[model samples]
Target: MARKLPELKRRKPSIAEQQRFILICEGEKTEIAYFKALKAQYRSAQISIEYVAPAGVPITIMDKVKARMAELRREQRSNPSVKADTVWAVFDRDEHHKVTEAIAGRQVSGAQVAYSNPCFEVWLVLHHEDYHASDDHHQVQKRYQKLDRAYDPDGSKTPDCGFLMNRVEEAENRGERQCKSREDEGMPFGRPSTTVYNLTRAIRAAAEASRPKRS
Candidate 1:
């Protein structure tokens, strides 16, 4: 009697490119806008980013990301083929010890994390011309300089997420006055500005470069 050959167990093919996921601290409106822009800009093909709030401080956000990563690790163990390719935690370097603690914690946990330059405002410094300065500017002339000469030629613009945010507010104010008869207020945050898209693209490019390549 001829026995049928054992049916071959076909397995699903693995992904051709690695997938990436990141977590960034959620805080003020400007920071939120910058991250949103970054995600929108970089959102294509192989990478993904998400923003999560720790509800308190930068360290809290780090903890959340780490916990999420741990959960992902467990998921990968069961699937064997699926794994989180990257995890990053971003926050501002403002008047708090949180940024310092977050960095130190990541180093100790042996986890890979990412951060924005000069705090979350780094993106802001890149966009607006008036906010770029070698030193902080409190005056209204706002003689800000380009964040870096390399990124902005002719010394005309900085990423200035804050400026973008202010313009959004100005536009909203004008619209509100024009439509005084109507009560429907335009959102205070304004439309998702280009800063979100631009910064996100930068982060995506950076993440791709930083990811390990399989030989």
Candidate 2:
């Protein structure tokens, strides 16, 4: 018999095949730090996370996110398998009128927006206790002060700040209740609502799903 053909080498799957979460945020550091913390806490190794910030105001953030994702997809044509599995935008409803437009407008390339009414600090405050008052971001900061006097608005979180990561589940429950209440009522945009919790839940689910089986 002729010599056996040389064994063919199999190409292993590259890291590019892994699932990814693309995030565009309004803040440069706080949201980025928070997500980085969540990624670590959840040990989401299977899912790659890309966060883009300093992305301008709400509407601008949306535009940048869509444009960047489009560029990525165009470059990824060589390997369609390498692409963002999920895309999301995180922004606060502070004085930004464009926030509503960003929310109501059509999602770009199926990217979802996670907007916190008043401000994202509201979601952070919910970690300690439930709040439904229709106040602005400063008021939300006050609530946070009750839990941690050293809270900083410019994205400074000390070691104790890490505690918020532990109470994520509690925060999600509280936030969902508020979100449902807002939906039931006829409240408009920036009226004490937040979808940050939902985004967190989605990330958590993706992380769990990406985990390898024990067997």
Candidate 3:
């Protein structure tokens, strides 16, 4: 006889849903997974969260995010009840950071958006902020030596920060690799959501606490 499979069950929503919105990120799969995890945890809460991009695209991230914020602000201005929520622009501090100023100048054109009154905000996550693999000096040295011949043919030592940021790319690549490996093995993979997860939850909790006391 074949083994019986576990029974499937459906979970019901428990909390009243509120509305909240945030700018999504522009990066690889790792970035989206983080957002999805946080969304899952807060989905039942009295909050409605919307994202700017479900598919990661670096070129349009900043522009699209700013556009979304402007749209939200415009709507909020007309409708007092509607409010601008937080925008988290998460990016990797890989080689991209070196060219970000130029990219920001040409690609992203506009003033940054701030959140609504009472409690409004923005968040930024640099590649190295959460976790980094190249912090392992041994690995960095190994990788640097391999790339030195082509990148620094003259053999002069490269700046540590620049080299480290390059290694940050390696870290990100490794993360992508790990994610792929999990998928290949038929398993789910994701980042630890302690930081973004807690931040969003705290925002919701604080908002709830500060809401006008009900009669």
Steric collisions counted per model: 17, 0, 5
Tens-place lDDT per residue, model 1, 1-215, is: 99999988865544345465555555534445554554454444244445664445668777877786777788889888774556656564443566667867776554555443234443343344322222322221122233333223234343444335444334333433323322234422112111222324445565555554444
- Model 2 poorest 10 in a row by lDDT: 45-54
List pairs with backbone clashes in candidate 3.
Answer: 16-46, 17-46, 18-46, 18-47, 18-48
What lDDT does model 3 reach?
0.39
Q: What TM-score does each of the candidates earn?
A: 0.51, 0.81, 0.40
Per-residue lDDT of model 3, residues 73-111, tens digit only:
788899877644655444432323322452353234442
Q: Which candidate do you rate higher for TM-score, 1 or 2?
A: 2
lDDT of each: 0.47, 0.72, 0.39
Best by lDDT: 2
Instruction: Write the candidate numbers in order of decreasing lDDT.
Output: 2, 1, 3
For model 3, what is the error of residue 201's alpha carbon versus the real structure, in angstroms, after optimal superposition? Answer: 6.2
Cα shift from native, residue 71, model 3 (Å):
0.6
| lDDT, model 2 | 0.72
Query: What are the clashing pairs of model 2?
Result: none
